[model samples]
Target: MLDVCVITGEDGPHTALVISAGGVVSDAVAPPGTPHLRPETITLLSALLIGDWAVADASPDGARIEARGIVAAYAQFHLERSIRSLGHIDRTE
Candidate 1:
C-alpha cells in the first residue's frame, strides 16, 4: 500500500494514506485547509507521474490541466501510477 500525507506546515503532524494494489484510498488524515483535493495539485501530481515535475497553477478540476513535457519521460509511468492511486493522503481529525 502507498502512504499519502498532506503535510501542512501550520500543524506539526504525521500520518499515512494506504493505496492498496487495487488503487483504493482506504484511509486518510484529511489535512487541514481544503476538504477537497485541489485540482491544481492533482494536475501537477498527474504530470509528475511522467517525470515532468512541471508545476501547475491548480484548479477545481484537476484532470483538465494541461501536461507540460517532463524532463524525465522514462519515469512518467511510475509517477502516473502513483497519481492514479491518489485518493486522500490527509483527512481532518
Candidate 2:
C-alpha cells in the first residue's frame, strides 16, 4: 500500500490518497469542506508518477511545481530514513 499526500498549493490543505498493491485507489482524507481534486490535478499526478515529463509539463505551473515539490520531499524523507537505519546497523555491528 502506498499513501500519497498531495498539497494543492503552497498554502493549500493536504489531501491523502491511499493506493493499494493491486493499483486500487481509495481513502482520500482531506479536511472538512475540501472539494474533490480536479481531473487536471489527477492527470498531473499520474504523469509525474509515470515520469511522463511532457504531460506533467503541460499542467499549470503552480500545480506542476507543487507536485514536484511533494515528490522531492518524499524522496528526501525516505533517503534520510534509510541513512539513519544504516547508521543504526553500523553501530550494532
Candidate 3:
C-alpha cells in the first residue's frame, strides 16, 4: 500500500501524488467520473498500475487490512471517510 496526497486547483482540475512505503513518489490523474472515490484512491491505484509501489491490492471496494492498513488509516484520517469504494478498483486494466 502507499500514501497519497490529492492536489486540486482552486477552480478546476485535480492531481494526485502517491508516496510509496519506500519513499518514492508519483503523480497520477484523478478518475473522471468517480466522485465517490477519493484522490487518495486515484493516486495509490495509479501508482500500483505504474509500478511505483511494490504492492498491489487488486480490489477497489476495500483493501485488506493486512495489505493496506496504512492506506486505510491514512484515508480515514485525511479524507475523513472510508475509502472502501475507491479501494476496490483496477483502473489500469
Clashes of each: 13, 0, 8
**Candidate 2: tens digits of C-alpha lDDT, residues 1-93:** 122343222222323432211121333434444334445666687786788999987798666555544454455565654333433432221
Candidate 2 local lDDT, residue 41: 62
| Candidate 3, superposed: residue stretches over 4 Å from native | 1-35, 54-93
What residue runs in model 2 are displaced by over 4 Å at the alpha carbon?
1-39, 81-93
lDDT of 1 by residue, 1-93 (tens): 112343322221222221222111322444333223233544455555565544433333333322221222223454664343233533221
lDDT of the candidates, in the order given: 0.32, 0.47, 0.43
Full-model lDDT, candidate 1: 0.32
On TM-score, the leading prediction is 2
- Each candidate structure's TM-score, on Cα atoms with residue i matched to residue i, is 0.24, 0.42, 0.24
Output the better candidate (2/3) by lDDT: 2
Model 1: residues >4 Å from true position, as ranges?
A: 1-35, 56-93
Q: Which wins on TM-score, candidate 2 or candidate 3? A: 2
Residue by residue across 9-91, what tens digits does model 3's lDDT show?
A: 22222332222222223334443332233554545555665876544544444433323544455566666667777667664
